[model samples]
Target chain A: MNYLLDAFAWIADPAHQAGPNGIWARLGEHLGYSVVGVLLACLVAVPAGLWVGHTGRGRGLAVGLASAARALPTLGLVTLLGLLLGIGLVGPMIAFVALALPSILAGTYAGVEAADRVAVDGARAAGMTEWQVLTRVELPLGMPLLIGGIRSAFLQVVATATLAAYVGAGGLGRFLFLGLRTQDYPQMLAASLLVVGLALVADIAFGLLQRFATPAGLRTTR
Target chain B: MRWIGDNLDVIGGHLVSHLLLAVPPIVASFLLALPVGWLAGRVRWLRAPLLSAAGLLYAIPSLPLFVVLPLVIGTGVRDATNIIVALTLYGLALMVPATADALRSVDPRVVDAADALGYGGVRRFLTVELPVAGPTLLAGLRVVAVSTISLVTVGAVLGVPSLGMLFTDGFQRNIMPSILAGIVLTIALALVVDALLVALGRLVLPWTRPAAAAVVAPTQAEVAP
Candidate 1:
């Protein structure tokens, strides 16, 4: 308890808040990397997943890829990339993007696949083009799952982004590694708390986003 | 390849430690989750809280958990016990919900039939509900097995002497072969374990063998990270 209080006190201290190594700067770096990583993942995964789901040609392959990707250890990947690329933000970013990809891709593919077949048939019967049916109908209906995927991806990236510190990049994990090195248990606890706190906040915010972005009918049916 | 051949004994030792660190937690958590999951499935009030707790546990990042396990468990920083206990907690977090869902997925008609045939609650659960739920339970186990295998490497960061040591040592020495070897071995271990579990599931639940492909499709979605 005292350790926790001391950790909180350390975080509250203005000096820790204002310096180059302060919480704000580190938090910014963490968020920046996570956002970029997730965006890159989304850019690649969503389109690929959507195409695969729409075409129904590679669903099995997509799922297999996601599973294999998920099984790769993030820490190992980060270090491996760091070794190859010579330790910088790029290594961790690449790792984070890889980590984020599977969930989003799975979600997009599953969501689209789970869309109402009847509605899709109806859209086609009404003479909408394949692309039109996908973009306007399937994507809209699949929004909930897509958002779910994004939410999972966001949480994963943020949590795993702490590994940035391990690869000589700056993030909340600095406090964790630094605390471990210096035997500053309080700092370690504080950083862990920050990571957990950030994850929870992102989860809640995305939950709301999922609720809002999902169509009214779909929400009630689900 | 030469480096791997040379370090075969060392890598084998690490693999043993990794299995030691991983397998017990998975087995223990599965055993523990059985009763909790049964309770959650049977009792409406317990389900939400139980699943919520599991979700919270699952959400915790692995690195922080590994670092903090010693403080939480009163173990030495370098103790493998810390990793074991931490992984057990994680295993429980994953398995609890899976167990609950598996039990819930059992067809209610079979339960009703068992009850109608005058079997008591315990007998019905053991003979009917459990057998019916076995396939889904096995599916859940497959996810847990793969997940636990992957996560065991994370403990290497804290010096728990798993194959992850390869990563740490490789990074320190800038040795790509060792790092690649570790990654390959770790992933291969996961795949092998997953395959074994799938085969075991087939052997135990012959009725489910035909639908094994269908059963595995949704298992990927349940993978939380």
Candidate 2:
């Protein structure tokens, strides 16, 4: 009880705040980098997932890569990548992409795989090319799932980005690591609270996105 | 040939570290979640709060949680309390969902039948509810097990000598063989553990397979017998 209370006190103390501006400013910089990383991961994984799922041709290979990527721990992957890329944001960037890929691929695959096959077949029968069938029928049907994958990837990047602090990439993890080193309970608790809060917010945002992105007819079954 | 022959002991040590790092948390999470999940089902008011707390705990970043834990307690790789606490939080999130799902998966008709027969409270639960829910519970346990094994790597980020340590050491040294070995071993461990969970689930909850399938097979056929 005392430990939890003391940690909260430390965070609340004006004197304990880092930098001249406050924690929020520090947060803004970290969020910038982390969001950029997540965006890059989305750009890669979502497209790759769409291709794999929409085509149904590379699913096994995609699943294998995704599972392998997920199995690779962030610390090891980031640190190793850091060794190759020489630290900074690039290492964590790659690691988060690897972390987010499986979920994205799974979501994308499950989404398109679940699409009504008859509609797609009908489109093809009605003089639509395979490409036209995909764009006009399959892709729209798969939008909610594709968006869901993006949402999961976004949350993953947000939470895991804290590890970037280990390599001096700077994020909420900085506060967490610093607090541990200094035995500053408040800072550690504060950082943890912020990260958890951010995750909850993201989850809520994703819930809203799901409602909006999904066609109303589809939402009922889901 | 010389390199492979000479460093056999170190490689063996790495393998041991990897196994040790992976197993404990899984064993612990399953044992711990069963009772908590059971308690949650028994106590209606406790379910929501406990689940929410578990979710919050689950969202914590692994590295940060490990680093912070040592400050609350003392530091050491063998600091079982810290490792257990850190992992308990992680496993708790999965377990709550798993347990709730397991319980929810139980056929309400089974529960009603038990009640209709005058098998009340603990008697009904021991013989009917829990037995019926067993497969669902084991399914949850499987998820918890897989998750625990993977996240145990978090312990390595704190410099605990485990499989994750091997990965970290190799990464620091830029040794591909060692790094690859760690990754491969961890995946192998996860696969083996998951397979074992499946086998255990099948053995313990034999009825679940048919029951689960039956639930979705045209409710009209199930007309209140």
User: Each candidate: what lDDT?
Assistant: 0.84, 0.70
The number of clashing residue pairs in model 2 is 1
Q: What tier of docking accuracy does candidate 1 attain?
A: acceptable
Compute the lDDT of residue A29 as modeled in candidate 2: 58
lDDT of 2 by residue, B86-205 (tens): 866777778777876677677889889889999978898778877777876676666666656666765665556666665667766766666565666667777787788887776777
Judged by DockQ, which candidate is best? 1
Off by over 4 Å in 1: B211-225
Indicate the worst ten consecutive residues by lDDT in candidate 1 chain A. Answer: A158-167
What are the candidates' interface root-mean-square deviations?
1.5, 2.9
Each model's total of backbone clashes = 0, 1
What lDDT is reached at residue A148 by model 1? 88
Deviation in Å, model 2, residue A77 alpha carbon: 1.1
TM-score of chain A of 2: 0.87
Q: Which ten residues in a row have the lowest lDDT in candidate 2 chain B?
A: B75-84
Tell me the tens digit of each residue's lDDT in model 2 across A82-163: 6677768777777777777777777877777777998878888899997787677777788788777777677777766776
**Which lDDT tens digits does candidate 1 get at residues B101-141?**
88898888888888889999889888888888898888777
